[model samples]
Target: MAGAINATDASKRYAVVTGGNKGIGFEICRQLACDGVTVILTARNEHKGTEAVEKLRGLGLSDHVLFHRVDVTDASTLSSLVHFVNTNFGRLDILVNNAGVIGLVANESALKTPEERLLNMMGAISHNYELSAECIEINYYGSKRMTEAFLPLLQQSKSPRIVYVTSGWSKLENIPNEWAKGVLNNVESPPEKLDEVVNKFLEDLKNGSSKEKEWPSRMSAYVVSKAAMNAHARITAHKYPSLQVNCVDPGYVKTDINFNTGKITANEGAQNIVRVALQPEDGPSGLFFDCNKIVAF
Candidate 1:
């Protein structure tokens, strides 16, 4: 049996929230610390990470809060994080893969004043945009790398849990094929097969062939990435029946991802994530949740 730390005796559980410097991730760290969990709030920017730690400290949760600089796309940084956790906490109870990007390329022309456009001979860039290469590199591959790097440490815990912050935009219905959808939606399928499906989808995207006939309803890159993540979570749960692994959609929270156009507050979004993280050992695994309720993949 894995070594288990008594939450009461230890005074808190240890957790790591990625991209936790701001928005929903920040709120998640705050809520977990409030619940007496020692949280490592990770961010790519050291200054931002420090500032967030200071803010959490100001809120009187410093004792349970720590900041670590991690760029999920970078392997060395991930190794450093694993080393730090192994040295300090000895075990990780919760991991929230909340780091993500919208992938929408901004139009530089939109930033210029109308008068300036009139004065210049050059035409303004269109408001409509497309996803960037960097977006896929970070949002999709970065999340996968983080999970892979931390899985060993997570296995060291008695009640390890992974909560993937996915989105409704990534539903299987948007995948557009019976076979492809079946491959992803099959919760009982072998991990290798599921991986093959995800790889095919990514390959199609790279070949500029995906979404040509029937495009995904929402942000294409974001949706596909989240779907892959949800599928991967199911595989993890199946592979490690003792561990609780789940994915969830925070339900359109007011965050930078949508340019602050969402309906819910950051705290409300964090509630669902925190709830999943704190689930009991027998709680549901390999499930997709939306605000505590199970939702379709």
Candidate 2:
């Protein structure tokens, strides 16, 4: 336990949602708050995060919602969050890792309509080593960092939950590199081994051998990162039997990630994630969810 366990905490639940300034992330915060859980709405941009919290407060969730600035890719920010939780709430009951990037570098002016954009995104967007590396850093490693930092605080809770907002692309089958896929698909693989797999992907990408290596040609980093994230979530669930850890693909919800071309609304997508996050203590763990249904990882 990081701080003196508050007597009042026994009856109260606390949650933190990353990238909570917009889209599905923002909705997750709102829904969790509505569910009676105190929520820390976090974002890399302080102004946006503050604005989001104010909006939630305006919705009459002032007592349940607050803003915190965090950049998942930065360890300092994560440490700061850990300190804040330890000092204030004393324990963390829920953590929703929703911060992610699409890994596509597109020319906005060249992109016309959502229909055409969705159909021809691959052709219009470009992928480079830097962007690919950043995607992996934020999507995969960033989630891992948040999990690791909060594990101690989470352990203090009677019922802890960890949700990784992954994607359907995270399915191992989407990873064309059989060797990489194999490593990630093996839930028994250690975290270091998973790191090695992601590192190898980056190495191959930087060397311009990703094509020869049989990795995904389009949105390669996004797919690989989410795959790694799903694998890590499984491993984490097993490692911490006291915690409910799961990965969720909230369907293709319409948000900025896909140029708002996705089919469903952000609220619909977030409900799927919030449902998993609020699963009962006896609920199943180490599973991949496609919206409300459990699917293969």
Candidate 3:
């Protein structure tokens, strides 16, 4: 572990970013560090995480960045991270849940460009129950666990913030399943409602009833998980008024997750997220932003 934050750094803002080894997450760490916020760049792989930190350090941000291994799907790692942050920084000012996986398997060779893939996503990609389950586990539940584990430390901060990297496809209008949509769109619904919606989707998936049940036929899990993530952010924001919690769709950046076929750069996408994470204490909560503009959730 790196040295504990000293008294001279007591007034600095501290952040923990999941999946910080590459792409948008990496750029998020860089941007935050450039802004003078102390960042703990985390990934499931220690080597990659450390290397990313070193890269940032090489840019003369040695004092602003560090690395810690964190697998969001694992409870022990999450717990360890919570303890690490509490011990080192005393409190966490920002938590960016940037880790996610696309549930669909794409035939990259069939598509030559980002525009091609975006238009013919259904024909190019296929999804299975296993992949769908894993998507929900990491994208939705992983973020939930991170938020719950860090809530105590966040509450201690003077300007706590939580930023979930969601997708534009997660908008309520895109969800075909009315039941799941209702549960998610209802801000009054309890957190348990999210579990109900997720469990139902998995069950339907396992039983081969997803399409018949009106769940998205292509990229179903990615859409559902992000939708759930957005809903969870709303519930969390309402439950914890002191925290500035928001979801952002980073505008399809050219990241590995999308086979580097996106329209924008990783830095551009990360800028969207970093903008929300560094919002002032008086900033709005429980809102979704498409890039930098506020949009309906």
lDDT of each: 0.76, 0.88, 0.89
TM-score of each: 0.84, 0.95, 0.94
Model 1 spans > 4 angstroms off:
1-11, 106-132, 188-207, 213-217
**Candidate 2 regions with alpha-carbon error over 4 angstroms:** 1-8, 124-126
| Models sorted by lDDT, best on top | 3, 2, 1
Error of 2 at 246 (Å): 0.2
Query: Which residue pairs come into collision in candidate 2?
Result: none
Question: Mind giving the per-residue lDDT tens digits that candidate 2 earns over 1-297?
Answer: 112223436789999899999999999999999999989899999889998988988999888888789999999988988998888888999999999997766656676787666556565323687888899999999999999999999999999999999998778887788888888888789899899988998998887788888888777888999999888999999888889999999999999988898899999999999999999889999999999999888
lDDT of 1 at 27: 97
Quick one: ranking by TM-score, best first? Answer: 2, 3, 1
Worst lDDT 10-window in candidate 1: 119-128
Clash totals for all candidate models: 0, 0, 0
lDDT, candidate 1, 1-297, per-residue tens: 112222333444789899999999999999999998888899999899889988999999867888889998899988888888887777788999999986554344654643343323122221112343455567666777887888898888888999999888778877785666777777687756655665665566666666563435345566666777788788788888878999988887888776566789999998989899998778999898977789878
Tell me which of candidates 2 and 3 scores higher on TM-score: 2
